[model samples]
Target: MRIPVPHWPSVAGRARADAGPLLLAAVVVAVVTLLAGAVPPLVSATADAAVRDAVRGSGADLQVHARMEADDGPGGSRARHPRLAEDVDDFRTRATDELGPGLRAVLRPPVATVISPTLKITDGSVLRTFQLAYLARDGGPAVSWIAGGPPEPTASETAQVPYGAPPWPVQVGLSEADAAALQLRPGARIPLADDQGNVKKAQVSGIFRPQDSADPAWRLVPALLSPVAGADGTGGTRFAGLLSRESLPDARLAFGQDELRRTVRFTPEPARLTWDAVPSVIAKVVALKAASGSSGARDGSLKWETGLDGVLRNVSAQVGAAFAQASVLLLTLLAVAVLVLLLAADLLVRRRAGALAAARQRGMSLPVIGGELLLESAVMALLATAAGLGLALAVAPGVSWQWTAPVVVTAVAAGPAFGTLTAARATRDRRVPANRSARRWLRNTARLRRAAVEAGVLLAATGAAVALYQRGVGGGVLPASAPALCAIAGALLLARALPVGTRLVLRRLLRSRRPLAVFGAARAAAASARVLPLLVLVTAAALASYALTLGAALGHATALGHATALGHATALGHATALGHATALGHATALGHATVDSPLASGLLRLTWVAAVTLPVLGLLGLALGTAAGAPERWQTLTRLRTLGLRPREARWVAAGELLPPVALAAVGGPLLGVLLARLTFGSLALPLLTGADFTPAPPWWALGLVAAVLLAAVAVVVPVESALRRRRRLSEVLRAGDT
Candidate 1:
């Protein structure tokens, strides 16, 4: 028996029929996508987590320390590289000879080193090394601290710094509460003599607060080993350190320097880098050494090459390859799904002979049927496109995702329109005797909706969601989100509503000229039954994600501006040059945090922050064009739509720029920042690529022209063809009815 979908023609019922179920479904899908999946990754990344745990014994994996003055520059200012301190002779043998294969052992060559600055001590008169300490006898003014076994000046210049003596060498934490005998803040300056028993001044750099981290708490008071200042006023005490992967100190040290490379091991396995990749890094460092070569370099210079634990390039490439394969497989899946939907639509349309005949007998216009059918095709295509996007969003954060939504939406939507046209080509015959086949299809509508039709819809949509989620969860592409479950349930209900949906819409919107629409509607309803909900849910997912992403970007930028400096750029510099490029992204030179409690925030200014205005403007222009293609296309469509005069369309399209203006002027730059931050995960910006500062102003104009021209050509050329074809159809059909 043919299924006749019930129509609710009353304005209220029709309204409900048209939009009711979809509204409910969107909420459900959102909820499901969230609760069923999200929150785990969020928890993992928060509250100070480590990707790898400690190797569980009281031994160090890698130790870090300053290279001696002869290798790096004197007094803790020079660069240093990490070297494996573990009796390399033994490990070297294990790697080359014994690592033959009893077990698959992987030792990735370490790439960079942590430079630990050193402190030297010298006194005022005898200006020896920085050694001043205290010795307590029968209380001859109570000897306080000892540096190299005697007392010394607590500060270099008395009135220069408002703050007292700078921090001491390796502090043995002392608290006044712990020792009520040492009533210690200001009046407790320890006196020193230059081997002449004369009083020399000494004040506390720290009176250990039990809570203060400065207190190492082993009891002996820390002595100021050197002068309070480095004489150059650089905060040689706190703001001194560099962590680099490729660059290193000039020479290797004796066995005592073992605690310098913090041995961090990757369990799933750290990828091994080849010796070849290090040459470029080695070259860059060599050039810097040459360009900024210190005359003091006559003492020594760095000479290095890639070793087992020195470069990560080879491992980085292998990981990228894995990601690339996953991307290819995903794209292939999308293309196959779109093709399947089109094929199904084609077969379904071919089978509906009576619907076409009835449409013709009723004198229902061709374009109306065509338009409605085409629109349904659009709906199908849109839904799938949306689903793909939904999948991407649902997968982002834990996984890297890249795509412009409108592009994906258009691709998916076009598939259906093309499919509809293909189906329409077969529906040319529109005359047939009305019989029980058409009448019966119009009769069993209720059961068709509740039973066979909805069953297939729910089954397919739910199955896809489950399968995708299972794969994602297991593979760790997507953590879990509450919205995921909502998305799935919403998709199911949307399908349940599809068979009767178009009929309800036509009954409400089509006047007398819609019989062909009605008949075509019946045919479209059943043919697309299994797929509708999935499509809608997917569409909602994509669009919702876009909205959420924009919000997230804005929020992130606001956060950076608030938490850090106003001129701060959020992108981390994986390499020195990349760090400089990231700085160029801003409009002006800004302060580097230089010191923060968190190591990530304490950055040394490598170069003066400067503008790359022309590049930035051009990039902005190109970005606008790329990001707003839909708006551009709409403007062009308005310029040449059938119903409107050119001026009228122009007015409508121009009005859209208002919101854009408002956003540019008053909208937070956070969205852009968030988007930029997201780029980090995808390996879109390499460590080296961020260094180009050659300003190209005129180049930006050329980019704008190219974008406008290309966008115009792609949109206009096809539209012109469509307009001419639509005009020709009008004359032929009286022609065909239209939207």
Candidate 2:
């Protein structure tokens, strides 16, 4: 004979039977996990792009300049002269060696120059000081000859001055523009005298112009390409006369050992500079500065200076601020997710109450019941978490464990924790006591607990606000939870206010002759006790409104031609009038930080992900929150209908229950969102992230539209839920109520 088979249901079968609540919880967990994986990497990438843009815009400021006196006392107390091309090559090797591999890739080849002190030019009737500059042609900016050719060494034997000048006069070249302005021509001999009455002669060899004026190589000696007016507070202009490497020997004598300054300038390679390399580059720069500084006194030996470290530090600070702000958004989403999970758990427990109660009657232990429920919750959490993480990795690749861990832990724990709590409460005794004093005592205890929780939330919000205010955005990096704390506190406060407003409406309905309105108001007043749903709705509404407002602002910021909208109209017109080359240079410089640039585009992309995702999540969460109460609401409505209430009257009661709080959320959400945005924007450096001059502010119409849409959505959900609830038979309703 064959053994009879047992009929036991699978966990999947049970989950499918109660899919409504489980499905919602699963979605919440998965989305939160996905965000945990996706958001940080996107924020980091955007921040890196911003860092690159800042470093690129810094231009010549990122250059490291090391100055060493060409003539110093030798081993024995003599003025020492630096070797012409040899010193240049030696410095480059030293720079690369000091920086090592950390900064070597970003470091451009060093350009060497020998500069002379201010000397009176005695060639023209106009008085002027000309600085005799000899830039080694190797690795220098490209140039085109306008007249004559590059400067050459003098051939005269007597031309060699006391320092190390050639035997003849030093020959120099000037820019074509400088030549025309100074009324000097090639082959003209000009006499120059120093403050110490040391006279030297210089012959103009050829006039030249830079192929690319914006080339940073020209920035090494700025005055070489352009005439500097009133350089010494005198009426005369200042000019730099360029000489070839061959003229360095003659130039050394022309300026004297005391006045001769040799500089090795290293400009950064823009393409090689990136966010990850910033810290290493900064450390190397500091090390180089220290090594170069310790050589001797400030002006005695080689001294190095650069603004690169400062620039990188600034970018780091900005990234920190942006990350801190993003943390607030993440935390807010997490808080909303937790609240939604709690609501789902509440609904799930209520839905299973009949079966759970029957099991208890059959002597099933509370621990056994809770364990089974927990196992189911754990299974759901695990599956959702895995799917979410897989999706996040697929989208963004990297997982920031610090950010993801909290979300994972919360997701795994929230469902089971809430389920056990609800089950424990459900299995408690339900017999009513005859004494009013005991009931009064219970009410007092509940009031005390609520008061304590509210006080704790207020205290936490205050502490976070104080800390954030003290730190400010530029002060340094901040804890991510500060804004979230403040937002939760604000939402709680609004939630508390909602009940009072509903009570007032209830009182008015009490006075009114309309029975439907009175019944509806009574239903709304009862719902005040269920603060979790209200809190979730209020917070979600605020976030949704905030997202919309931010999206609109971003849209305006990234709108086409926005980069050129500011004063560029005239600039563009002027560029056209000036010439193609002039216009192109101006456009290139002006558009360096525009919205169309990679920096702004990256920022927009990251923010748009948030801007688009939040509103959709908020709406779905609101739907889940609303649906969580549907079973109980339908049970109550069914009983009222059996008690001779018309179907229309039942619908009115449901509307009453939903409309008051939903209307409150709609009105209060935008206001709260605006307040939250205002409070956090300064600390977040929002303008820096957007690359906009002003912070974004949503107009009244936008705020109003958000409120109206939320109200409309709730209004629509009311009838849909009512129609869905009406589908159940009376027998099913009575059985559910009994359970």
Candidate 3:
């Protein structure tokens, strides 16, 4: 005979009746998947942007220009020497070859020339001049000019002034001030001399003036040549002239070796490279220098200066470490979601246990019953997965295909699998004996199984802790996973201690003369079935407390580091002390922490957001779990009311039972969390938090806040139970038969 499969119509009808709990389970799954899909990319983009801003602001990617120094002899005497054109070219070529495609263009502006000139003006009065090179490469002389811009060079005129070699007969450019002082114009020939008194003739090819006297390029202009007699017969300094790069060779030849060596300053215009490519460029340069040393080749002292390598490494490490934390948090949320769903499934199964047992008695096979349950679970999972994906897309659009596919698969599979397993476990064919004592049931082997499971969890958590400690929080799952595992282990240990502690408290309450206390204690002592739910509730609250405390502590540390960094910046004159001081003072007054730099601010924000979000998620999970247990609470309250227990006494009984676990979690979770946070803080590569002198401390206020929130949540259970009691009729509740 073919076994008749359960029809879909019956399953659909049952699911419709149970829509409230099913919808809640679906929402929890949706939320967990949404976070899993969204956090990684958001974190990566934020880190990259912060690092880029920090590197760019510090000018770390700009190439430095240094004078070549030579060790003269066996005694190791060193002297500064002019960098030859060939030497610069060779270094550029090595840098390009070593760095490969990542290397962008290299600029080598011609050496600077110092010239002192005595110009014979049209009026026959003498004018003194000081001149230095003005090149066309990074927005030239005209770019800096405010009035009377530099003469535009023709194609042929530009071709004449080749790079690295200056043109003869010296083409020079003059600032408008210098030209006005001498009554000179473009193409006007002027006589110039070095400090050693050697003279040469040069034509002014351009005339320009600086927008600001203190413009960096203007500072390159040599100081006024020796003073000249003014029209009033008193000596006055002449304005400096801006010469073309083509004037360098002619000036060098005219001035001769000694005076040119003493006075002229040659600085290559800096090359700008991308922020990401800086570390690679530095590495290549170092390798080339090492190779050159081994080969006994002539080496130029190329002094590379930057904190960029450290900054980049730290950025990458911090991002990795933070993502690890996010992963752990995501996993915790998922675990909680799964547990809540399973509990909902178990509750649903228990409510229909009589129907399930009756169906079994009528020759319904386990496969048929399991199939119906699985089908219902599958429907819920499919709907939940769809809702989750939609929510994820809405919140974090452009999620990578890798993250999206896995999240979808996990959500689809997880709900149905867990729900089916829970239903199967709750719907066993054997009947529970009506005469089983509460204490005997509480001390049963199934209770031993729970203890074993807790032990296994504690062992696993210990292993994870060892692995995390070995890994040292550099940039991976350990940073996040360590805390999560510790929280779990701590929660389990706390759960194990609750029954014994509650019995002792109940015994003490039984001796009281007060009827409320005696009744509440008796009720709490007999409520053996509430152990698991109470354990879950306490664990969730504890996890939330721990997360908040850790986050607040990290935020405070980040703020302190930033404040210290800002103070250092002000002391070093990098920023105005008055402005920063005022801002910092205001922030302090407003009870907001401030960071000095962009990188620190980004890190601080990440910690603060995680801290706030994780606890809220834990609370949400707790609320769903509570909602699932409402029916049982209502039935229990109905039975109590029938035994002459008042609604006020019922509320007191609920509070008495819940307060122990909530109080335990509140005290234990933070202490364990604080310890975990202290251990994990060293792993994050935050500049401010990692140093010999850096000591991280817990945010005590945050711990207190978490305790208050948890206690309030526990307190809410009483009112909720009372509200649930008020809504149900005594007749209906009495007929409900111990649900």
Which candidate's TM-score is highest?
2
- What are the lDDT figures for the candidates, one per model? 0.29, 0.67, 0.52
For every model shown, what is its TM-score relative to the native structure?
0.29, 0.78, 0.71
Worst 10 residues of 1 by lDDT: 602-611
Error of 1 at 229 (Å): 7.4
Arranged by TM-score with the best first, the candidates are 2, 3, 1
* Model 2 regions more than 4 Å off: 1-10, 61-83, 95-105, 116-133, 136-167, 171-245, 276-300, 359-375, 394-397, 425-434, 473-480, 497-512, 545-615, 677-698, 735-739
Q: Write the per-residue lDDT of candidate 2 for residues 592-683, one digit (tens) a residue.
A: 34413444455445445554555555566567667767776767788888889888788878888888777777778778877766676565
TM-score (C-alpha, index-matched) for candidate 2: 0.78
Per-prediction tally of clashes: 72, 5, 0
lDDT of each residue in 1-739, candidate 1, tens digit only: 5443322232233224334222322222232223212222222221011111111111112211122232233444322323322223233333233222311233322212222223232233222212222211111212232211221222221112212223221212123442233333433443333233323233433433323323221112222221223222233221111111111221122111332332111111212212233344334434433443243343222222212122223222322322222232222222222222333333334333345445535654454545554454444445544554456347533322232232334333443354345445445666543897876776577557656755664465455445444543223223112122323334344444554654465466446564434433433343334343233223232222322332233233323433454324343322223322443332121221111111111100100000121122222222222222322333344334545445433333333321222122111222222232242212311111111112111222332332343234324433443354343332332322211
Candidates sorted by lDDT, best first: 2, 3, 1
Which candidate leads the pack in lDDT?
Answer: 2
What shift in Å separates residue 280 of candidate 1 from its native position after superposition? 24
Give RMSD to native, each candidate. Answer: 21.9, 6.5, 9.1
